[model samples]
Target: MPHLQTVFAAVLLCGAAHAQNMIRGEYWIDQDLGFGANNSFALAQQPDVASIQLPISLNGFSPGVHTIGIRTIDASGHWSLTNFSTAVVTTEPEPPLLTRVEYFLDQDPGFGEGTEVWSGTGTDAPGIGSLPDVSALAPGSHTLFVRTIDSAGHWSLTVHAPIVITAPDVASDIVRVEVFNLTTANDPGFGSAAALTVTEPQINLVEAALWSDDPLSIAQGNTLAVRSMDSNGKWSLTNFFSADVVHTNVADLFTQTGITTYPNPFSEGITVRSEDGQPLRVVLYDPQGKLVHDKVLNGETYIDLGQHASGTYTAFFWKELERIHRVQLVKH
Candidate 1:
């Protein structure tokens, strides 16, 4: 009975001491004798506890099995016995990339969102021919977006390809096409001075804008109206496109770009940079993953976002095929 009471007292004392000590984890690769705490705290609690998701650098470790250790160091400078866990390190597979593209008429009901017929379920692979059997599509014009999914289930961005399904002998379907200028001048005479005459009816699509070549040439207010003609020489309805011009007053720069943004919900412009001594190319994407801007930098660059609508954006810094850094940008 006396021995039992002594053991109980010792256990209680250890638990009380631990309540005041700061507990942390350390790691040792393979059979290394020395332990290091380069990693973040796995667990830390006093009266209250918090969880942090900060990225831990693991550059020093190679692909192999390693044992990780955790211990407690109290305020009185006493070290606790290290507890260990085993870990296996392996390389993560790279995402697959789209190589080739071909399209056919989609005959299946409720298939794709766009006008083109497509099947979403298929084998995603690298170097494998992804040509869909087009022998079933009807004669018409369509488009397809091709993407690849890596073995790790990471899907790559899509790329668009145009496809034309020609009829037995089709011609002379076009008539006269009309466009309207709704910005600086509201034109009724089929846009500008006159309407466009479709001498060759095979043209399925028409595109025009005030800044067709130079985007900067467009002013603060501008819009474009466009439509097409079919084989019966009958004109289709008109589609309108508008643009909101923006200000380009930005001048300050930065030094590094490991997740950095200023005025968080920023206006007018945003500054970006990275530690990469060489020039950096920053690619900006909207919330929908649509690319909005691409710029090259020499240490620092001021991106004019005054014209862009207020929203959250993602910025990725690239070094050739490798993505060096990624961060979020907010525009007010």
Candidate 2:
């Protein structure tokens, strides 16, 4: 006879169409005790299909070799085939522990050449108390590689972490700032936009109203773009805000703008006629104020709208940075 050993029995049972609930289960070791006659056990609950974990006794037999079988019975009195498994019991051995950890920056100094961060007798070395100085390294990106050796002298795969070094900041002067139009025909181009006078190296707020002799046409949707220049003559990217209605001089909208759009209630597409043959940007927005189409046109250009849903949309015509005309369009 042997001391009783607890074996974890994972039992799974499939129910037949005539049977839905698994009602009981049993297990036997080494020899057959016939169905429903082996060591029976009670399940916590009855389910249509059963998957459960229970403990089976491994006693009254030698530890050298043994076989265990499990089965279940359903409400319809159908017994599942035995799930047989073999067990081999033996004494356990001691496990290895972590003995050392080493790390290197940028380059691999090779095995023992890396600075040792930890050395002790333990299963784990949690944290590194001391780190190498990085002040001498140049300002840029670098990688730190780390590895560990176990008590059995086995080295793990090297792991690395990326690091970035930031340099000290230098003062830059604010020479000038400018404002311009992006879609208007009178775009002064980059450094050519109207400059705003400034005397400080850094500024938080800017107060100035920029105007053009020939401004963007009076429309609901219009923008004025502005940017700043450093003393090094580098111009910042344009920042735009909605333009307020200052004054209005009604020009010949059709003749002066030199643009025309045909097929008012268009089905498939529409045509834009540019009389002066200059490049113009056309943008269309759907009823919910979503932009549906946008393109730059030169001479006479045809825009196909066959893919858009049937709805009323607003179209804005722009010459360079200036918006010259805006009209409502219907697609049927």
lDDT values for all models = 0.47, 0.69
Clash pairs, candidate 2, are 182-321, 183-320, 183-321, 183-322, 184-320, 184-321, 184-322
Q: How high is the lDDT of residue 325 in model 1?
A: 44
Error of 2 at 233 (Å): 5.8
Candidate 1 segments whose C-alpha is farther than 4 A from its true place: 1-27, 32-56, 75-77, 85-88, 94-100, 104-332
lDDT of 2 by residue, 98-183 (tens): 88999889999888678888889887897786666678889999998889888888888999989888987656776776665454
Q: What C-alpha lDDT, on a 0 to 100 scale, does residue 58 get in candidate 1?
A: 40
**TM-score, one value per model:** 0.24, 0.41
Worst 10 residues of 1 by lDDT: 1-10
User: What are the clashing pairs of model 1?
Assistant: 105-137, 173-230, 173-231, 257-273, 257-274
After superposition on all C-alphas, the RMSD of every candidate to the true structure, in Å, is 31.6, 19.7
Off-target runs (Cα >4 Å) in candidate 2 are 1-86, 90-95, 116-121, 128-134, 139-141, 164-169, 181-189, 203-205, 208-223, 231-237, 241-332
